[model samples]
Target chain A: MFSELNSILNTSPENCPQGEFTLVSDRKADASFLIHHFLSFYLRAGCKVCFLGLVQSFSHYSAVSQRLGVSLTQAREKGQLVFLEGLKGALGVLLEEEPSPGTHMLGFLRSPRSDLRELFEFVRASSTVLLSLGVRVGAVVDFAHYCRAFVCSKLQGNMVMLIRGEDEEEEECDEEGAEWLLRALTHQCSLALRVQGLPTGYCRDIHGQMEVFWRGHGSSVTGPQTQQKLFQYKVHDKGVSFFARGTSSAVL
Target chain B: MLLDIMQTNEVGGLVIIQDTVDCCGRQLLKGFIHCALKRDEVVHVLGFEVCENEFRGGLDSKFTQGLYFHDGYTDPLGWTECPPLTVHHFTPQDINTCLSQSEQLKTVTLVVDSLSWILRHHSPAIVCQRLQELRRGGALRSVLLLLHSDMHQQGIVGSLCHLATAVILVAPGMSGQHTVAKTTRRTKSGRVTREEECFSVSEDLTITIEAQSSCSGKTLPEPEEYEADPAANLTFNLRLSEVEREAKEKLSLPFVFSQEKKSALLHPRPGAGRILYEPDDNDDFDQEDPDDDLDV
Candidate 1:
């Protein structure tokens, strides 16, 4: 006996909601179902899990995880196990970039292999919705800020990019210059997202800024479209981004 | 950048990394501890998936202690309900910059969460250069006992190994009936060294299967392109010497040109691009042959 499904589904608020809720399936492929299930549960739990895997098809797991969010442990204990596909609904974030329209492209470390630590602030803020929003009183984000933060927080998902304005190279790089250009995107994670390169699509240098493009496709209805400016960064911590979370899910 | 040394001068200390320590400082400590330890040691850690709520809960004398930690990216909630650990939460830049930047410890025992993306994002050359520079600055006293995981897609780790005082590679050893293989080859001598020692990290992030023994000259890291830089100024320094030689050669040219011709020319005649350093008497300057006549 669920209270409502599409009621709040369509009007989903911008804030990350923490509650105990069940996820329903909408006839997606096997992978989509599993992904949706777990994603819904985590979203309600107020935990941001950066679901990473192959960049395509992650539904079966999503759906199953969503359906059994609460009783999954019990289900397994009673010999009632629901096995789902692993590879569906798997595209974590899309990549698209073209060129930036400014005369600025600075290398992070050096030309050929530039260092990228300079852009960590922007990336960190963009990764978590709560990180981008106003201060939290308890766990509640300001509703208004929540909307903008939700949109801005996902620069990698929905933002389109146009790197390299005119065919000019050689740009000056100062901390201030790159910071100004590497601001947050407005809307995040949508279908028809555009990016040109790896990670962030654009880089600003002494010459100018270049734009890359990518498209983000949420659960098919295609979330709002956006284009994150060429906000790029390269962190120097070689082992920082990855940590073995201990044989996650035991190979599922 | 000056804090990576250990009191002992050996290679690598047992580095215990968790969200409670500074990534940068602990990294240096890794090198420092390795360099300082006279005997093999064990490093411990607890955080994230293992002890999220109790990340820094067990630093008491009762529980095992890790050298230090830098909270890179901890679980959003932190180790459950615990007030943020007393440890500092430095930005990625701080940790990254100092890994090689700090020379406090060499021969460090480094234990990190993962090594894949970190290797790709930050080239190991930069890390080594930072370490080398620190070493030159007398920041570290000994070799480093590095403790790290081989993130599946690590880049230039082989090259990084070259600058290491000694390398200790740990990974999944083997499955039932199958032998797990992770080998390091020395670049100078193309010898293939098999590793009899093995290491395993338990689910609790504790160190296991450590068979630390002193073995010399097992392997050399490949002298790949990533191995080229350490002095950071090698290119500039070499280029300057080359330019100086060329300038001297140009000034000592055998040309009998007018004073104005020599005065006006900034470099060798348009086509000459070589930096010939030797002062050969047979430079053909004095040859009577028409083909050998010096021309500006």
Candidate 2:
């Protein structure tokens, strides 16, 4: 249902789109549950994923992957699997640029943009803006500036931006983000600009009309939605590559 | 050690304030997290509450999000009121419904902060089955259950240890607590090495590990330099030949090696059917003391 976002600290989006993550007293019994369900979804979906904050070598993913015949090395080289350190580097690269404008594979998500350029020039003319977690307060204020011209899309997506803590303001992601973007769409709201964050899920209605999101610091969000946040990498953990960039190409 | 793995990004580390945030276990968790932030790439702290459930004499969280993060500071002693980077909350029922709804949901890592309460809701088997479901999804990330060390021996917990990809056993050693991460799922054919480590949870959420003074003046790699990933593969074979040496040196117990493990420890026999029957010699002495004092 989504790109795998497995992490010791995060829930892999590949296995569960609207998944539930819990921190129990002991993870031993539950380790397999996470791996199986997540891999079932991720392998079928063909998403590039990562895992972060897990302990030891052959800890979780490696143990299972060795059993399943997946290669951590192949995944890493092919851009499918990743670790926390790799995730950090990816984040660094993405945040380094402003999101590129044009037709995108994951929409603007896979689309690369740099911070070195002057932004907000295109967002003012856009109707909806999808942002990343790394996008700071920049896109919000920019979207607010165009709030009258075009209704802004809610900030939520895979590989997204969020506060590092647990208490983010609650919003119905399925209903609100999609509905608001569509409402803005019907009115032909123009100039939607998002902060620069490459969230993990698909944009239900915010794509065609210049969707905007962010990739900067903010309050952490929790509840089941917290699980939806990116884990370091999903496919990366399994040591397999070959994820689906195109919406229809995710192969099991 | 637990502190090393806890600091690494491959694991989810937690500290629970039992009877107010200062249980010895909580101290262990705090100390480890404080040190982890300084050494790892990215460390996240999921801060949840444990308010008393007056009716049930239990605990629950104040907000929906059960997670919070405290980024490492230049110094662990400093504190701040700044909002956390992430927070997520949910009801129990919603949690179960999610897995069933997904077509092929892959839930790789499920790090439980405390097994005590979750176990309170269901059995270790129930948690185990859920984990089995997650493993059916795809490639697993890793699973870490952050519970007090005492739970290490419970059958319910032992079963979890049996199912764990890696079991990180931490106990207060002669010089604080030493962690031994053993992979229950791994069958490594290499030399196993054991080393001592120090722990402290900084004011920030990172867990710090310092080499014990015994190994001082020796140059060692930083926590990350220990290996590509020492924590996940970090194992001390409990069933290995070296266990006796650890018991003598680290555990300080009379570990008599025998053909079978059952004969090692003296514990109460299994329950008969659904009943528990045992007599403690300490209770018999205490019972006579009260009567003797009463001149009965």
Residue-level lDDT for A154 in candidate 2: 20
Weakest 10 consecutive residues of candidate 2 chain B by summed lDDT: B51-60
Cα lDDT of model 1 by residue, B1-296, tens digit = 01112333343222221111001112222233332233333332212121222223222223233234433323222222443321122223333344443343433233443332233234565655654554454322332332232221233555555565334332322332111223333222345453433333222223233443344234545668347656776545545577788887778456668677766686567786767666488665534574554554
Top candidate (DockQ): 1
Please, what are the lDDT tens digits per residue for candidate 2 over residues B111-163? Answer: 34344434433566776676565444333334444554332235666666545
lDDT of 1 by residue, A1-252 (tens): 011221222223243322111111111111132233334433444343333222232343343444544443343344333222112211111111332321012112123332222222222333222111111111111121222222333332111111111122214322122111221111111211121223223322211121222222131111111222342112111110111222222222
Among all windows of ten consecutive residues in candidate 1 chain A, which has the lowest summed lDDT?
A20-29
| The candidate that achieves the highest TM-score relative to the unseen native structure | 1
The list of candidate 1 runs beyond 4 A from truth reads: A1-30, A39-252, B1-66, B74-124, B141-155, B175-194, B198-296
TM-score of 2: 0.25
**Which regions in candidate 2 have their CA more than 4 angstroms from the true location?**
A1-252, B1-4, B7-23, B26-109, B149-153, B173-196, B212-296
Instruction: Give candidate 2's chain B TM-score.
Output: 0.38
Docking class of 2: incorrect
